[model samples]
Target: MTGERSVPKPLVLQDEDARGSRLKNTDLSDSFLRNLKMRDVEIRDVDLSSSEVEGANMSDVRFHNVRMENARFDNVNLTNVSITNANLAGMTIDGVLVTDLLARIDPDDDI
Candidate 1:
C-alpha cells in the first residue's frame, strides 16, 4: 500500500524569539531557521529534512517517529543523550562505522 505525504510549507525566521510558543500542523521543509532558540518546546509529527542548526542549545527535547536520513552533525555538545531502537546502518563516528566496530568487538551482535 502506498501512502501519500503532505508537504510542509516553506518557513523562514531570522532572529525571532519563539520561546514558549506552540506550532501545530505545519510543514517546515526547506526552511532556514538561524539563531532560533527554543526552551521546553514540544514538537510532534514534524519533518526537518535538510535543515541546518548551528550554534544553538537544545535540551529536554523529545522526538517521536522522526526520520533523520542522511543528516550531518558537527561540533556540537551532547549530554545525557539516549537513542533506542535506531537504524544505525552506515552510521559513523570519527570516520568509523559503529556497526562495524561493534561487530569486531562482539563478533556476533544480534540485538
Candidate 2:
C-alpha cells in the first residue's frame, strides 16, 4: 500500500488569550487570526509572505531586515515613517517610482 496520509483538519482557536506567550520555531502558515490584540509585540525571523492584513493598526511598528518583494500596501498611514539604507528599487509611492523621485531630488547621487 502506498504510504499516503489524509490531511489533518485546521486548528481553530476562538476566544483564547495568548498574551505574553512566546512562540518559537513554530509554523503558523495559512492561519486565520481575527480580532487579535497584538500591541507591543516583536516578531523576528518570521515568514509572512502572501499574508493578508486588513483593518489593522500597526502604528509605531518597526521592521528590520524584512523581505517585502512585490508587496502592496493600500490606504496605509506613513506620517512619521523613516526608511534609511534600504533598497528601494522598483518601489513606488502613489504609482510613482521612488527611485525616480529620488533622482529628481538628487541627480548626482546614485540611488
Q: Give the winner by lDDT.
A: 2
Clashing pairs in 2: none
Write one digit per residue (lDDT tens) for candidate 1, span 1-111.
369786555665666766666777755555565555556666666666666677776766676777887888898666788888888999998889988876778546565
Q: Which ten residues in a row have the lowest lDDT in candidate 1?
A: 27-36
Can you give the TM-score per candidate against the true fold?
A: 0.64, 0.82
Question: TM-score of model 1 relative to the true fold?
Answer: 0.64
Q: Which stretches of candidate 2 lie over 4 Å from their true place?
A: 1-9, 106-111
Model 1 clash pairs are 8-27
lDDT of 2 at 77: 88
Q: Write model 2 residue lDDT over 17-79, tens digit each, in one string.
A: 888989898778878888999999989888888899999998888888888899999988889
Q: Where does the lowest 10-residue lDDT sum fall in candidate 2?
A: 102-111
- RMSD to the hidden true structure, all candidates: 7.8, 3.8
